[model samples]
Target chain A: MIGCGWGLVYGVLNSLSNIMLLPSAPFISIRPQIALPMAVGILLNPPAGFVVGFIGNMIGDGISGFGIWKFWNWHLANGLMGFIPGLIRYFGIVKIGTVREFGILQMSVVLASGIAVAFAVLLDVCFLHHMTFPSSFPSWILPAFLTDAVNGFVLVPVILLAFRKILLTLEIRTICLVTILLLLAVFSTAVSITLSILDDLVSQEAVIENFYIAGIVSVFLLVVGFLASVVFVRRFTDPVIRMSRASQEVESGHYDLSLLDPVSSRNDELGRLSRVLQKMAKTVQERERSLRQQVQDLQIKIDRKRKDEEVREIVETDYFRELKKKAKAFRSS
Target chain B: MAKIIAIHSFRGGTGKSNTTANLACLLAREGYRVGMVDTDIQSPGIHVLFDLDTNDIPYALNDYLWGKCDIARAAYDVTKTLGADATGRLFLVPSSIRAGDIARVLHYGYDVTLLKEGYRQLIRQLPLDYLFIDTHPGINEETLMSIATTDVLLIILRPDQQDYQGTAVTVEVSRQLEVPEMYIVLNKVPVRVDREALAAKAVSAYDCPVVGVLPHDEDMLDLGSSGIFSLRYPDHIISREMRRIVQRLTP
Candidate 1:
């Protein structure tokens, strides 16, 4: 039920992107729709991903007045794009928890796009008897792979983020910013290629070639940037996370702060903060101990009010008054 | 005229008798002719502390209260018993320890007036500079009569909850009687207690001067009531504290 419902939605979205007149290569439409099935593949099951991609592409082709069975190779290519990332289910990762898992999710998307496009090219060459090899590589294979790979790479994390499948840690936040930059780079390059085609600024073949190269270069840059961000952000935020955990320990009345030694020795603001926290805990512990001792030694319980009343009972008597008179008379005598 | 000093407590076993015996020896050591009367008629134990043997009593305070003898006849010059080097004379009017004598005083009760007259007779006869009244614990008619005539009142107590409450009442009573001078003496305090601090606390507690906070002495306990603690351990910590109390009371 989920597969058919999502497949129809993907088909409608694909048709909508086509109508939007976005910057794209000749005969290769800019397909942000590529991320939808890949996200579903990773989020849902692999078979569900295949069903969404295959059936969705078929519905899309039929809606655009292109015969669905005519380019059956393209439907299979899209299906494989979703199916490869869906293989992530075997890693026991229902959601991205660490930097390594995030890398795997993105790498699978890129890997799936390359293999899927290659599979289609091989089928078109062997079964359909499509003309030419080296010439077809640039126009069909390169364009197909770059379009799917870049779109899926940039948008899958975004979809996963929106769906709450990824935790918004420091590493994930940096990666989110990096994805937006990649999308901007991809968008600008596509627009320049489209302008080149429309205004006749350069030869179409040369322009298309440069577009594919720029797309691939940006993907590598995004990968390197993602890795560097993971390293840098993890370094900055781990100490904070550790200190937060130690503070919780202190709150619960456990003053064993052996874990904070490294953080406290850093000679930074956080280290100074750690030292202050440690001193506060020690002071609290000392006060508690001394309080217990003082309660024993310093207190001598006596009720003065009650004693004053009791003393009044003996003094306010006729016998005491007469005795006081006789005692005073004798002392003067 | 001798200055009458009454030593008292609201509860027994606060070392009241022992402290009286120690102070008498301490005062005489300073060459003041001191006279002490064991007014703890119901259960008198002060005579034992002065090493006054049971058989040596020709007359106790019981004889004078009964009008059987003059109060001076009951007075014994106990100064020589503390050693011949003692300069000033020290006298003790010990309470009788005989079974019938104790029972008659408890049963018929002594005239409280005679105690003041006896104190006057002792001062005139022996010409004492200081007269010590070793009072029985707790409030009684005679205890009040003794307190009423005193020039100075010393309330002794131990570091105990019952003692704390009892001493507080005794302090209020002495204050109401308009005693000329008043002070507290904390005795048999735990040796580990901070003496200076306890002394300060007691002063603030009673709104009265604290002349002493005496530590519990093992030797004093070992000696029990058979001998004077100040004379036996002249330079002992307890003796030193007692001497300090004497210094505060010297005027």
Candidate 2:
């Protein structure tokens, strides 16, 4: 019952967002809000995610006068986007702590987007007469895949982090901050360019030409910016990875700090951390060595004392004295 | 039959001579006829423990080995040195302490077989219950000869790394030589080490019984090589440890 209620609300919101699309291809426009239902699905149970996504997309098509049954395959695809992320919770990956966990979450989001879009195109080929191969692929498939994947990848982690489901590590915090800034920069640039192209009093052909040129430039910038941010973020995080591995070696009683040499040589906070860790390992190793030596020495001391007391008791015995006297007397006779 | 017991070590300064002197004295005090031979001709030190003047020794083991005298002539009855209440006999076969005698022996190594024969002759002539051979550290011809003929071989070593490694080599060689009974005595151990653990480690490393772990007693160090530790300070920890080791070696 709660799933149905969420589905209705999500459907209405999705329809409203769909109406505000930026012009792109003839049949496919950029849809950024598609991640909302998917995020909600993953946050809740799989059933809730599936119902909300499927019902919402149907209601959206119905309200847009496209008829609910017209894009049934796309509705199912949207339902799957929510369903896949919900599976992450089943796998006990609701909380992201390490880099590996975060990578898995992001990869799943991208894969879900690709799979959903591909499913829709497959359905269209088998049943519907709308999408054709190669020509329709860039317009229908590429736009849907890129927009949904980018949105889900960016927004889901942000939502999870905000909900405190994902632990906020230094690496996560920096990446999130940088991503938000980069998104803002990209969105404002594209928005201003789009608004100017729309408001132009030039001919329709000129408007179309200007819009195409702006879209091409925006897409090119997005790809370049994403790649650049990845490389830039890696520089700050790589040392952390190296230091973590070095600490594991130290924990296992290996005092060799040569592996952390490169990290310690750097002139940054991470470098200082690496040096501190190396120092800690050295201190521990020294303590263990001294302790072992002390233990060995203590054993000898205790043994000496104990053994001496034992011999003293034997020598002082009356029996031993009597035996000595008898032996001396026997020798004399 | 007299038991020939050889006290050996792989490295010097492991208290082998001190231990040999003390063991001999302790046994003699217990009414057993003990004979101690300073087979370490190059640096004979057991004579000093008995307070025997090197110049007073008219016929030493070197003289016996050089065919100048009988082995019994080199044996000195030092039972009086035990100072009263020592019911048993103690005779010492002092090595020639003269620098030329030492140089001559080292330059032209003495007959290893003759030295073994001398030990037998000394034991039989003195009617000794036990004859202790104090050997030089490391594997030399005389040391090997002494080890091969001994009824018991006591390997002395400190708890130091160098001593431990050298001791292992000596132990392995003794085992290969098929010595009847072999025991390890960890000497000069610091008071801080765990005695039982060190004994266990030594036993496991060499596969030999550990007779004693003698700590670095201040009395022993202060006394130096002047006197027998067990006889001087009979109740001292080091002396007691020596007694225990002697008891094991004899039995």
Candidate 3:
């Protein structure tokens, strides 16, 4: 199921990225760069993302009538993008704080996405299509670059933000959420594709036109597949954000942050996020207590200083009177 | 799934290379396919232990990192050199001993992430039971990265004040990285010192398990890096200790 779901994501990303067509102009489409975010997402959650991206892209291309040969080539190339990053994460090449380290993770994604798309185009034109080498390069390079760059710029950040929220809040068990999302994506894609095919067979319009409409709808469903994943992720994410904000308020000396009900286990991502927020709230409360103690200590010091001043005044007056009596006695003698 | 064990120390002269080579041999002897990587690009020497002369190494880890060759191409199988029944396979992915390659890599560091991908690719391609990473000493980008990914991190140290202080730094970093399991091996312990007392002190200091207390052996000095000690002299006491460590590692 996880494999199938990731496969769906890969499929949609591949289709949208349009690895199939090699445009002659150097125009950038905002689609190919989605591969970068998808690749990064897989790196974060491997089992689901890997299988989905790997097999899904292949299946997506296959169903689009790219022929089995082209499908495998594209699959191998795109799958490698996910596979390489996943391996790097597994082996500790790309550490957790890479984005913080280089400040170019976003840029790297765009660059790498462009490279992957370029490689995919190379594979398509060179290996699969058997086009003449340098001649075909001009036609494919521009479009691949533009599309990949756009996708990377747009999609990488969205995925990164989603991952950050999920990781920070502990809103969902990564494995479970990935599994569920992958299943939904696969189910939806299958249903949508099946419906389109049935509609084309039953209706009286030209098959190509019907198929085109079906393709568009399938692509739409794929987009929906990603949206559905976002929705599922968001369900648990919002409360985590609220709870974290509340904890931050408490940290800033606002002790009255609300203590709402603990997130339910069934709440998935949101539940995990809430649990973290609860811990943060406890920490904030501890800090606030410490601050209050420090304030009390300051007040005690002031009170002590006031009492000491009064005692000093009383002692000084008594001493002066005693000295005056002594002086008067001496003068009488 | 292959268990990727990265053999590391915070400082040099902790016997990291010797330990990695010996452990790989031990694992291979026990009917496990093991691959050893010499990631210490600056000072590569593991190849000598496998009796692989400079001329014999067709490709090195440096070549693979530079995209000149696939990682597997650099792997040198050295089971026959151990003088055991060659059923177990050991592939040595050595670093370039050439001064030029070393200088180039130091001047311009390759992508750390790419090295990681190479490690994974080696495991997948070879279907290795264990991949031993011989790392450079101290806290560097590569060492820290390897420690983060390892299933088992073995820190080799000698019973010296400098080594003790350095080991603490490595241990703390490993702890921060949240390594799943960590152990310390007290290597080259002098015969004069009470081994038990030293072991106790080490355990108390690090608060981690001590797998072995290997004595400084004259035979090891004589053999040097020509051959694996455990394989050549299975009856020796050091070999026995090494085997015990290997047993703990084997699943």
**Residue lDDT tens for model 2, B147-169:** 76787899998887667666666
Q: Could you give the DockQ of candidate 1?
A: 0.29
Off by over 4 Å in 2: A1-290, A295-333
Per candidate, chain B TM-score? Answer: 0.96, 0.97, 0.96
Q: TM-score for every candidate vs. truth? A: 0.51, 0.46, 0.43
lDDT of 1 by residue, B1-251 (tens): 57899999989998998898889888897788999999998888888776786567788899999999999999888897567787788999998999899999888997888888888889989989999999989998888988888989999988877888898888787776778899998888776667788777778778999988888878988998888878888889889889888888886
On TM-score, the leading prediction is 1
Lowest summed lDDT across 10 adjacent residues in model 2 chain A is found at A324-333
Model 1 regions more than 4 Å off:
A1-297
TM-score of 1: 0.51
Report the lDDT tens digits of candidate 1 across residue range A1-333: 787788888887777665544333344677888998899998888888988899888888888777778778888988898899999879877878567788889899999999998888888898875636977766677777887898898889889988888876655665666666666666767655665566553677877776776677667766766776688678767878888998899899888787788878864466778788888888888877666664454456788678868877886788876765665565567
Q: Which candidate achieves the best DockQ against the true structure?
A: 1
CA lDDT of every candidate = 0.82, 0.78, 0.67
Q: Deviation in angstroms for A159 in model 1?
A: 68
lDDT of 2 by residue, A158-223 (tens): 777777767766555565656666775777586757667567646787777767776776777677
lDDT of 3 by residue, A226-275 (tens): 78668867865666666777767766767554543545343444555556
DockQ of each: 0.29, 0.05, 0.00
Each candidate's interface RMSD: 2.5, 14.7, 32.5
